[model samples]
Structure formats: C-alpha cells, structure tokens
Target chain A: MTRFALTVEFDGRPFMGWQRQSHGPSVQQALEDAVHAVTGERTAVHAAGRTDAGVHGLAMRAHVDIAKAIAPFRLMEAINARVRPAPVAVLDCVEVAPDWHARFSCIRRSYEYRIVNRRAPLTHEAGLAWQVPQPLDEAGMADAAARLVGRHDFTTFRSAHCQADSPVRTLDLLSVERVRDRLFIRAAARSFLHHQVRSMVGCLALVGMGRWSPDDVEVALHARDRAQLGLNAPSDGLFFVRADYPDEG
Target chain B: MTRFALTVEFDGRPFMGWQRQSHGPSVQQALEDAVHAVTGERTAVHAAGRTDAGVHGLAMRAHVDIAKAIAPFRLMEAINARVRPAPVAVLDCVEVAPDWHARFSCIRRSYEYRIVNRRAPLTHEAGLAWQVPQPLDEAGMADAAARLVGRHDFTTFRSAHCQADSPVRTLDLLSVERVRDRLFIRAAARSFLHHQVRSMVGCLALVGMGRWSPDDVEVALHARDRAQLGLNAPSDGLFFVRADYPDEG
Candidate 1:
C-alpha cells in the first residue's frame, strides 16, 4: 500500500464537520468515498483537523492509504472527478511514507476568524463572516486577545464536551487587527480543543464592543471554568487556514 | 414629496438583475417594495447602473421620491427591516434635491472583477469569484490592461445589444493586480455599455494565461467590432463597487 498526503480546501456549510458522522455527510466521508470510487479500495482518510459545521478550510491536510500505485496528480484528478458537485477540492497531493499519519504527525495548526463590523447586512460575505452591526474597537479587542497568548489553562475558552485530557495548551499566536470595516482574529497552536478559537473570539468581540475589558479576559482564563467564558462565536466566521508537518520542507 | 438618494448593497445571485422584470425578483423591485412596506407610498426607484444576474454590489446609488419627510437614518433602518430576508441592504440614505437624478447626476462609477486563479474548486468564494484552474501571469495581465485605459471607442468590448448612442467612452482607469492567487481588475468610467467590464476582463485573462500578448489587446480595441472581442466573462465575479455624486460629500 502507498500513502499519499493531500492538501484540501472546502466550504464546510453543507457538511457535518470534518469527521465522519452517522447523521449527515462529512468532508472525510466525501473524500473517502471518492477514493473508493477511483481505486475500488475502501480506505479511510484522516484529516489534520476536524473543523465544526459551517467552518471553512483554506488549506487542510489529510492522508489516505491505497493499494494501487498511481501518480499523485492522477489520484487528485480521479478523486476530484468522483467528488463532483461538492464544494470540495484537492489543492495538492504528494506521495508520503506509508507510516505517515495526517493527524498524528501534524506539528502546527492555524485558524482565522472574520467579523464584518458595519450597519449594513452582509451580501457577498453573508455566510463567511460574523456580522456585527455596531462598530468594534479593534484596538480594544487586540488588547483583550493579547491576554490569552502564551501557555495557559484555557478551560474557560474550551467547549464543555471537549475530550482533551488537559486544559493547558500553549498558544503560539493570538492577534486581532482591523482591515477596512472587518476585524480579523488569527490564532495558531499545536492543536486546539473543541470551540476554543470561537470562544476566544466571542470574548474578544465583547471587549471590542466595550462590554468587556482586558481584565475580564484574564479573569475568565484564571477562572478555568467554561461558564465564565463569553458566548461562543458562530462557526461561520472560523476558517482552518493551515497545518504544518515537520520534515516536509 | 421629498427626494431621497440611497446607497445600497446586495448579493445579486438570486435576482434577475438590477432592473425589474417578470422573470425573477430584481434589486430595484426589492428596494421599492421595502420602501412601500415602510411608508405606504409607492415610489419609483431609479439606479445609476443596471447589473446583470449574479452580479453583486457594494455601493449602488438610487433615487426615490416619498410623500413623507423621514429622517435618513430611520428610513434606512425601516427599509432594511422590511426588506425581509433578501440579500439586500440600504447602506446609507440622504435627502437630495428633486432634480438630482440617480443616473444622470452620477459623475463616476467604479467596478471590481475578481478571479481566483488556482487549480482548486472554490469553497468560501464560490459565487463571489471566477475560479480559473491555472496559474496566470499577473504582470502580463496588468500590462495588457493599461492599453485599454483613456478615451476610446469600446465597440469591441461593448455588448451587441448595448443601447448606448455612441461607442466612444473615456475610461478613467483599468488596472489589474494580483493578491496571492486572486486577481483583481478594477475599472472606472463615467458610464459603460453592457458587458464592457466583463469583456475587458475576459481578454485580459487571455493575456494573463499567455494565450495573447499586450499588443493583442490594443489590436482588439482598435478593431472596434463585437466579433473581435473575447468571450464575456461570467457575471458572478463582477461587483458594482460604487457610484460617485458631486454634491454627496
């Protein structure tokens, strides 16, 4: 069997997230089915991150094992053909060692959340951004977001049902900036717990609107309780931007 | 009656066009209906430009007359509330003199066309951009676009059914630039014939792809014949960005 690593991009609006579920279609299921259709082998596909429903991916990494030996480009073409009409595409494909795993071998992951701060309703970016009718103080949001960076027990920012063994995670980056009428929050880490990024954005949004202060975020982080967290931001604004693998370069 | 000028935004994917028609809902119809719902007065709304189906707008200018003297902010809020789930919004409203026509009084109009040049199926920007699965030489495209700037007879790029009395028009600007994998083509003019911007982009895309040279654009412009034009690019990627009025500021 040969292992192939693929970079994928998808609109998560229609799927039930990246992982396979019994209820509806998933990005994993769609890709696995496409692989089966192309190679006639039932192979499982693993993603670097399992994003939630309504989230988007600019560059997601995945790995699949198959019995047939085919060129990476040919595999991409065949799989894309089978996955017709779905808003998913393989951006790049590369042959990798058989032991490489998409999820386990990943070293870093990055996400971006977008908020359009304007009085008008979103038209072109309707489902792709979080719309805040009132103006947001981006500098204030940045100040609040800065408090979450570095190593911390992010329990307040994590989902109640997150299955991670520990709440402590090292956040490599947390930044907020304004471009035109949009506020962008970028976060990067080795990994994340369920709803961690969204929860953090939600808190920062409150700070942006003058409802919360920088000290509030610090207190919430120290509280180490999910109830202390702000409202979770909608999944629509979140985008899984990239996954980094060691030894790739 | 008081005359009001409104600045609007919309995602035109579901609408027939900017003009009202029996085939499907139009942006004009939606605005007029919302106005009537809010004020109980039927008013004729006239826009500066008529965009095709699937074309979005950022700041379209329109004028309407209403019997009641309503505050601009309240009128904006009321109309937006009554628009009813449509992908349309009245961004701003201002009182104008009765003779200030939306179409005739406009001094300049600007448009932006987006093309995502990459070998991947679009996910987040499906309907908002034209997806071309190939690498485009942006420098070549920019060079070719410069040839179309300034006053000229645009018959080669004008639609066959365009009703403009003369094909001659002064193009204030036509610029092509690349940001990552996305190509932005911005055009400015006092007025344009049907399909003018799209036709220009279609030809520039050819230059970007190495299918044509910069001189070819000059030759096509001089041809001044519709038959000499490139294919009309899809309307989905075009945006009616803004319209300028002299006295608005």
Candidate 2:
C-alpha cells in the first residue's frame, strides 16, 4: 500500500461541502468515486480542511491510500480523466511518507474572503464573490480586524454546530485590504473553529459599514457568548487558499 | 425621447454574442426586452462593439432611447430588476446628447484576453479564461506583440467574413504580461476588424511556445493575405473591457 498526496482545486457551488453526505453530493464522494473507477478500490480520501458549501478551494491538500501498484503520475491522470464533467481537478500528485497525514500532519491553513463593494448588481462575480451594495471603509475594517488577531476565546465567533472541544485558538494573521471596489480579508492559523472566518468577516464588514467600532470587536470576543455575535457572513465569498505542511516548503 | 448611455457588464457564456440573433439568446435582445418590460417601449439597444459568441463584456458601452420621462437612477434600477438571471448588469447610466452615438461617437475601445498558462484543468475559470497546457514565455510574446502595434494593413489578421470596408486600422496598443500562471493580453484602438485581437494573440502564442519567431509575426503582418495568419484564438477569453468617449473624461 502507498500513500499519495494530492493538491486539489474545486468550485464549491455544486457540492455539499468537502465531506461525504447522504443527502447531497460532495467533493469527497466525487474524488473517492473517481479513485474507485481508476483503481477498482474504495479507498478513502482525506483532506486538510472540510470546506462548507459554496466555498471555493484554490489549492486544497488531500491524501489517499491505495493498495494497487500504480505510478503516481498514472494514477493522477487516470483519476482526472475519470472525473469527467465534475468541477474538480488534481493539480499535483506525489508519493508521501506513510506516517504523513493530510489532516493531522498539517501545521497551518490559510483562507481568503472576497467582497465586491458596489451598488450595481454583480455580473462576472455573481457567485464567486459577496457583493456589498454600500461603500466600505477598508481602513476601519482593518483596524477592527487587528483586535481579533491574537489568542482569545472565540466562542462568540463560532457556530452553534462547531464540534471543536476548545473555544480558544491562536490566530496568526487577520488582514483586511481594499483594491479598487473589491475588499479581501485574509486569515491564517494552525486551525480554525467552525464558521470562525465567516463570523469574523461579518463583524469586520459591520465595521466597514460604520455600524461597529474596533472596541466592539474586542468586547464581543471577551463576551464569549454566541448570542453576542454580530453576523455570520455568507458562504459565497469564502475560499480555502492553501495548507502548509512542515515537510514541504 | 431621452438617450441614455449605459456601462454594461455581462458573462458571455450563455449568449450567442452581443447582437440580436434569431437562433440563440443575445445580450442585446435581453436588454431590449428588459427596456420594453420596464418602459413599455420596444427600443433597440446599440453597443460599441459586437463581440463574437462566448465573448464576455466588462464595461461595454451601449445606448437606448426611451420615450418615457424617468430619472436615470430609477431607469437603471428598473432595467436591472427586469433583467433577471440573465448574467447581465448595468454598472452605470447617464443621459447623453441625441447626437452622441454608442458606436460612432466612441473615441477608443479596449479589450483584454486572459490565458491561464498551466497543465491542470480549470475549475473556477472554466469559461472565463483560456487554458494553455504548454508553458509560455510571456516576454517573447510581448516582443512579438510589439510588432503589431501601430497603423498597418492587417488583411492577414482580418477574418474572411469581416464586413469592414478596408483592412487598414491603427492598433494603438498591444501588450502581454504574465502574473503568476495567468497571461494578460491587452489591446486598444478606435476600432477593429473581425477576429483581429484573437488572431494577433494566436500568433503571439506561437512565438511564446518557440514555434514561431518575432520576425515571422512581422512577416505575416506584411503579407496582406488572410491565409498567412497563424491561428485564431477562441472567443472564451476575449472581453470588451470598456469604451472611451471624448466628453466622458
């Protein structure tokens, strides 16, 4: 048996997040089916992060184990060829150490949220980005975002469905910048609580719209109550940017 | 009657082209229908450029005459509301002089062609960009593109079915730049013949891939023969960026 690491990119509009589900299609089921078609094995596929529905993946890290004796390149090609019509592609594939895990061995993960600040309705970026009709004060949003960058109890920013045992996580980076009419919020950390990025982005947007202040964010963080949460941004603008492993640069 | 000029943006994948067609849906038809639904006037919509099938528009300039007296803001909102699920939007609108024509009064028009230089299949940018599997040397493509800048007889690049009275047109700018794995080709001119930008990009792609030299591009331009053209790129990546009028700035 050999373990192969795969770098996958997908459009999340059609899938029910990254995990397998009985009610709807998912990225994991599609990849697993493709692997079955290629190798005749029902090998399980594990990803570094399980994204929510309508969340895009730019370079998601994943790993799959197969007992079939096949080259990495051939397996990648065969799987890609079999995954027809699905909006998923394997960008890179390589053999990895048996002990390396896609989820546990990963050290860091990065995500980006896109917001198109405009009054007119979106055309090219309809589903790809979240459109905010009001003009945003990006500098204000940046100021408010800094208050949430350090270690704190993120209970107010987590979803009710979050299953993580701990409410505290170290946030390495949280930045907000505006380019023309588009606003980008980038976040990086070892891991994140469920809906943490979206919830943080929602409060930052309120700041951008002049509904909240920097101190409000810090106050909310200290409250540690989900009822005190400002808002939970939609899943349309969320993207899993990449996952960083210690072995690979 | 009041003449209103509109800055439009659309995803061109669903429509046959910008012009009205009997066989397939067109952007012009959608706009005209929306105007009729809003103002009860079956007016014609004229555009600065008639893009080919599968070509997108970023900020295409167009105009329509409405007999009803309505505020520009209200008219824009009404039209936007009426054009549902069409992948088209009016970014801006304003009243214009009766003599100001969308097609005739335009001083310059700009276009952008996107090429994703990679071997992996596209997911998010499926119909938004052209995927070139081979590696491209953008510097070489830029050098070849420079040869096409300036006034010249471009019969070699004009389409066989082009209706322009003459093959002579001044190309104001042609530039190629690579940002990461994406290549951007920008072109601007007062007007263009059919298939001119795509034809130029196709030949430049050959230069980037080492199949043709810069001299070959110049030789083809001088040949003044349609058969001498190297290739014509697909319409998927072409975008009508914007149209410039003298009085706007």
Candidate 3:
C-alpha cells in the first residue's frame, strides 16, 4: 500500500465533525466514501485536526493508504470529482513515506478564531464568524491572552470528553489582534487538550468585556480545574488553519 | 422629512439585485418594507449602484427620506431589527441633507471583481468568487488594463441591453492584482455604463489566458462597437464596493 498525503479545504456548516458519526455526515466519511467510489477500497482518511461541527478548515492535512496504483494528481482529481456536491475539496496531494502519519506526525497546528465586533446582526458572515454586539477592549484581551502563551497544565481549558492522557502542553503562541471592527485570535502549538483554544479565547473575551481582569486568567490557569472555566466559545468562530509536518515547509 | 444615508452590506445570492423587482425579492424592497413596518410610512430607498442579479455589496451607499420624528441611530436599529433573517445589514446610518440623493449626488463609484485561479472546484467560496481552472497571467492582464484608463467611448464594453444614452465615460482607475492564486480587478470611475466592468474584466481574462494580446484589448476598445466584445463575465464575482459623495470622504 502507498500512503498519500492530501491538503483539504472545507466549509463545515453541514458537517457533523471530522469524525464519522451515526447521526450526521462528516468530512472524513465524505472523503473516504469518495475514495471508495473511485478506487473500490474502503479506507479511512485521518486528519491532523478533528474539527467539531460548524468549524471550517482552510488547509487541514491528512493521509490515507491505498493499494490502487494511481498517480497522486489522478487520486486527488478523482477524490475531488466524487466528493461533490459536498463542500470538501482536495487542494493538494502527494505520495509520502509509509511511516508519516497525519495526526501523530504533525509537528505544529494552528487555528484562527474570528470575531465580528459590531451592533448589526451578521449578513454575509452569519456562520463564518462570531458576532459580538457590545464593544470589546481588544488591548485588554491581548493582555489577558499573553498569560496563556507558555507551557502549562491546561486542565481548565480541556473539554470533559477529551481523550488526551496528559493535560500538560506547551502553547507556542496566542495573539489577539484588532483589524478594524473585527478581532482575530491566532493560536499555535504542537498539540492541545481538546477545547483548549476555545476555552482560552472565551476567557479573553471576558477580559475584553471587563468582566474578568488579566490577573483572573493567570489564576484560572493555575487553578487547572475544568469547573473554573468561564465559557466555551461556540465552534462557529474557529477554523483549523493549517498543520505542519516534518518533511513539509 | 429627514434624509438619512446608510452604508449597506449584503450577500446578493438570494436577491434579484438592489432595485425592487416585481418577480423576485430585492434589497431595496426588503429595506423599504422594513421601514414601513417601523415608521408606518411608505418610503423608497435609493442606492448608489443598482447591481445585477447575484452580485454582492460590501459598502453600498444609499439614502431614504422619512417623515417620522426618529433619530438616525434609532431608525438604523429599527430597520436592522425588522430586516431580520435576510442577507442584508445596515452597517451605518446618518442624517444627510435633503438634496443628497443616493444615485444622482454620487461623485465616484467603485467595484471589485474576484477571480479564483485554481483547478479544484470551489467549496467555501462557491458563489462568492468566480473560479477559473486555468493559469492567469496577472501582470499581462494588468498591462492590458492600463490601456483602458482615461477618457474613451466605451461602446464595445457596454452590454447590448444597456440603457445609457451615451457610452462616453472616463475610467479613473483600473488595476489587476494577483494575490496568491486569486486575481482581484478593482475599478473606479465617476460612473460606468451598464455591464462595463464585467465586459472589461472578461477581455482582461482572455488576455490573462493568452488568448488575446494586450494590443487586441486596445483594438477592441477602439472598435467602438458592441459586437466586437469577446465576453461579458458572470455577475457572481462583481461587488459594488463603495460610493463616494461630496459631503463625505
């Protein structure tokens, strides 16, 4: 079997998540089914980030093993052609080493969370961004975000159903930037404890609203308890931006 | 009566255009009906650009006169609240002079056309951008576009069904810029003939595709005939970006 690496982009509105579920459709099932239709092989496609429902992906990295002797471009074309009219598209595809796994081999993962700071209700950006009606102090949010940048036991951020064995992880970067009336939160790390990004963003929003001081964020991280979580931001604002691997730039 | 100016944004996928249509919904009709519901007055909303079907608006300037004793912010909030569930948002509103007509008093108009140069089918940006699978020579297109600037009788670019009395118009700016795999064509002028921007962009695309030479563009422009037009691009990628008036920057 030959392992093929693929870069995929998708709009996550109609998806149940990256993982297949009995209740609804998923990105993995969509691609796997497309692959089966094209090459007659029932294979599982693994992604670097298993995004939740209502979350988008710009360039989610993944890998699949196929026994068919197909060219990389031909496989990508077949998958893209069969995946529609689903909102999944294979952006790039290439052959990779057999040991290179999609999830386990990923070195860094990045996500971007968008917030539209405005009074008017969302029009074009309804499901694409989180809308905050009240004014947000972006500088304060940035200050609060700085406290969660380094290594820590992020127990307060992990979801209850997270299957990760360890709560300790090093966060490489967490930045809050104000672009006009929009606030963008960019997070990067080797790995995260499930809802870590959303949980941290939610607390920073509290700082933006003056509800929680910057000191409160550090205190919550030190507490390391899920009960201290202020809020879990909705999945609509989050996007799995990209995943970095060792062989790739 | 108070003349209020509004900065509107909308996703034009669901409407027949900005003007009121007897067969389908329009942005103007939605806002007018919302105004009637709020103020109990039959009003007409005039916009700077009356776009074609399936075209979007980022910050289209518009005006409406209402005889109600209401503040600008309250009127804006009421209209936004009532126009709910529609892909239209009143981004900003302020009182203007009675003579400040939306269309007649406009000094400059700007439009942007987006082209996604990619082989894969669109997923996240289906209706938002026009996807061309072929490679585009953006620099060549820019060189061809520079030939269209300044005063000219743009008869070859106008649509056959255009209602303009005169085809002579001054194009202040036309620039083609390539950002990664996306091509953005921005155009600004005091005004434009019907289907002028789309027609120019379609020919520019031909130049980018190597089908037409840069000199061919100049020859077509000098032809001064509609039959010489190569193509009229789809309205899906066109956006009425902004409208400038004398009183406001």
Best by DockQ: 3
lDDT of 1 by residue, B1-249 (tens): 889999999998889999999988999999999999989998889999999988988999999999987898899999988886889998889899999999999999999999999877777777889998768899998999899999999999999789999999999999988898889999999999899999999999998888889999999999999998866889989999989889867
lDDT of 1 by residue, A54-132 (tens): 8998889999988998999999989888886778899899999987888999999999999999887877777789999
lDDT of 3 by residue, B53-84 (tens): 89999999999999989998999899999998
Each candidate's fnat, listed in order, reads: 0.72, 0.72, 0.85
For model 2, what is the alpha-carbon lDDT of residue B54?
Answer: 94
Give the alpha carbon lDDT tens digit for every residue of A41-82 in model 3. Answer: 999999998998988998999999999999999999999999
Candidate 3 segments exceeding 4 Å error: none
| Worst 10 contiguous positions by lDDT, candidate 1 chain A | A118-127
Error of 1 at B75 (Å): 1.3
lDDT of 1 at B96: 91
The weakest ten consecutive residues by lDDT in model 2 chain B span B118-127
After the best TM-score superposition of candidate 1, give how far the Cα of residue A125 lies from its true spot, in angstroms.
1.4
Q: Residue A144, candidate 3: how far off, in angstroms?
A: 0.9
Stretches of model 2 off by over 4 angstroms after superposition = none
lDDT of 2 by residue, A1-249 (tens): 999999999999899999999999899999999999998999899999999988989999999999999999888888888876788888889999999899999999999999999877887777789999888999999999999998988999999999999999999999998998899999999999999999999999998888989889889999999998998899989999999999787
- List clash counts for every candidate, in order: 0, 0, 0
TM-score of each: 0.97, 0.98, 0.98
